[model samples]
Target: MDDLVTLWPSAREASEAEDVPRRVMITGSEGYIGSVLVAKLLDGGFDVVGLDTGYYRAGWLYNDGKDRPRLLARDVRSLCAEDFEGIDAVVHLAELSNDPLGAHDVRNTYEINHRASVAIACNAKLSGVRRFVYTSSCSVYGAAGDDMVNEESTPRPQTAYARCKTLVERDLMRLADVDFSPTFLRNATAFGVSPRMRFDIVLNNLAGLAWTTRRIAMTSDGRPWRPIVHVEDICDAIQATLNAPRGAVAGEIFNVGTDSNNYRVSEIADAVAQVFPESEITFGDTAGDNRSYRVSFEKIRRHLPGFRCAWDVHRGARQLRALFEHVGLTEEMFLAPPYTRLRELRRLVESRQIDSDFRWRCHDFS
Candidate 1:
């Protein structure tokens, strides 16, 4: 918060246009998903303002350009009403992204993901912000078995990450009314390439391992079903939620991604194998792994006509393959701490770059 003093103005002083707002404030704007979404919003004719703590700033695979939106280096927990003064919409993407990262500290998961998110929404609503697009995860569907779960499905959250998503969704729905329309987008497992590329995801990890080690090995039996959407499609969905009319999106929870994009773990491994023909794959035991869900994405499809998923697993795998080849990716880089969120956060804390509360020790850390 102190670092933001010199870099960013107070939200009241920051607004260039007060009457009309083509302005959007995106939290975690430098993240794997946020980095891509910021560019999309900019291209879509919005005056974008980014807020991020730069937790994953070290996770660079390559530079797509040094260019970034006007960003505030601040944590979401510290954000006040002054931060949302002229913001038209707030796309909340900051959180302990996945299950393992959420598990690292359950209290932090509830604190940052659930409690902090609700605080931001309340502040946004209090500040007269029109919309709040929350990036919830499909992992909340936990173990829905072979049945395709929809927005109304009973969520059996298996991890702290999933539970926090459910909590935020429930609380945000309660906040929605005539003034503030909060849209909860439960995104499927995200894939595809970005500047801050992550190898912890199923598709990206499998493809990167194949490219670097020429081998794909699964710890689980590869039997659990997962719905996946490309990173760009997710950005499109966020943009759609941002631009939609108030009445249409008010208190709505839409599952992002496509119904056709669902695949088992083994199928993703097979797709990776196809992309890298020389790679070998090994399937492990599936007895104990209970996480499996096939999500129904019809709600988002029907609601947001402008949104469409362009890339499938095969296309995304090929994209990752091209990226790995271009960067000369190696086994060491594949297993590096930066590319994985939990590993990188652990490294940052252990090295004293950030404290246990996730606040940076110095501006140099950003």
Candidate 2:
């Protein structure tokens, strides 16, 4: 922790010595969304710094040949105010991502997802960072049925992960002030190809199943509504939030996705089938996972006028199919441990690479 904090003191001095470009720090910079967001911010002419614990670093699906930012290979829980001193904004995405991973150990989930995230926001505020973009989830509206839930809707989180997102949003709102403006972007379910690919998400998982085995075997009846947005679109929302005026975004919670992007589980499967026509599809009678919600993204469209979703589910499906065909994806590759968050974390804990608390036992885990 000291070593990581010490490295940023020189960065602070350099920023104080002269005017610099807008410096934005992203936690979980090496993960699925962070990788894409880092590239987007760089292309937009922002000085980017990334911090990731490198849990999913082993999973590189494909290289996009984009320049990456200077990454700090450190845990979010170990960060302090000094680490964020020179940063103008902090995009917090470093957490145990998704539901099953959170269910694997509920205690650890709250520790990192809720408590540690709040701590990081507090640190960022203390260090004089002006803008904070928190990558929240639409899953906070869990089990809303057919009724479209918006930012004002009461959150009925059904999992540790979703619950923690709510907790962080609540806690961080208290840290918001005239100087520290925190924006909460409750992003829709993310799908689309990335260098650090994840097959655990609904659309991505279905696409992977369709590609590898030519079969999408569903465990549920596929009746629940899910609002999903492309990975790139999620990045676009983050960029928009960063560039938007502080008064417009501060203490605001915007669901990130378009109104038309919400689809029933069965529809998502059908879209994937269209991309891979040879794939067989089946669904069970039971609702396997209870978490489901249809989110209204009108607030973001109204608040951030420049933000718009560029990729829909169909386009995102085609993108995945193209990448899969280009890479010649096989069943083994699709079922790889790192592509799924729960599987990879379990492997680490069982192999003693990371301890019970999810800390790396050694620096040479790779």
Candidate 3:
């Protein structure tokens, strides 16, 4: 009874300590999801410190007036334990983000996504950072047929990008302890507005094509299933995980999306076409892009009641159309490197802005 009374204030103090403004460090905070998430965290009163190699800073679609967080323009591979000092949590979003970029150089994908990510998490754990929120992807469930897969389902990651996600998730789990809580948010395909927007994604690409070219089309048959969530809602999920009780999120894996948001590529094209009446729809098998998965988001809903997907495909399409109309999106801009991750990375490589390892190359002006 005396011991219980003595421990009560310490426990209460710890809980109250967490209630104060948290200092969160987000890697890849200049990219698509990272940009929006930084703003959302700041608006939610988190003290945000952003770190990025600035691979896509020139890829701005528009000015949203969301100021960049206190930033460190450094590569994730170079992150040391000292970087985690004074940080309450670390949101790991840095990577070779998609299939095309992964396909471009499989070795680099494994290096940055798999190896570097695990290294960062290990450092965070060593530095005593309590919460590590990994922005994993449903792409890890590559080619999961008609059945809806959940956190327990066997991951069948097909591409190098997806394979790295599974590897990182597995590696991070090994570091989880009472003092270090790691949460893997296997996010569905992300869409909707962001200051650093990506049109390489299905819905965003189709919307861009429809608005700029007046045509909605696909290089594949458009049958692949993809569950999507809005960028803001993804931010919501991250924030929830950051503030969630340690017991609730410790080493937990949650599919970050709504079940109903899953759609076939053709369905997404149709939604975009509906938004732009003048746009014609086209489909063909230019390539065998067989990746498909229907994800179950029930775990997050049940575990983290505060996390909910607030955007659907139709709503996201409408939002994109409005943004495109407001900006007077041109075909040239739509097809530019700024809107596509793979293209932008390619451009950076060609110009020697970044080297083969995707590290920024220092200019030799002297």
**Among all candidates shown, the one with the greatest lDDT:** 2
Number of the candidate with higher lDDT, 2 or 3: 2
Q: The CA-based lDDT of model 3 is what? A: 0.87
Across 5-67, the per-residue lDDT of candidate 1 in tens digits comes to 233322334345432247899998999999998888887777899999889898888888745
Worst 10 residues of 3 by lDDT: 4-13
| Clash count per candidate | 0, 0, 0
Q: Rank the candidates by lDDT, best first.
A: 2, 1, 3
lDDT, candidates in the order shown: 0.87, 0.88, 0.87
Compared with the true structure, what per-residue lDDT tens digits does model 3 show for residues 1-366? 223322322222344665222788999999999999998888777789999988888878889987678999899999889989988789999998998889889999999999999999988888889889999999999989899899999999889999999989999999998888899999999899887889999899999989888889887788888898999999888987876667768899999999999898899998898898899999979265679899899888887776778899999999998898888889887888877989988999999988888888898798
Candidate 1 error regions (>4 Å): 1-21, 287-289, 363-366
User: Mind giving the per-residue lDDT tens digits that candidate 2 earns over 256-360?
Assistant: 999999999899999999999999999877544887788899888877767789988899999999999899899999999999999999999999999999999
Task: List clashing residue pairs in candidate 3.
Answer: none
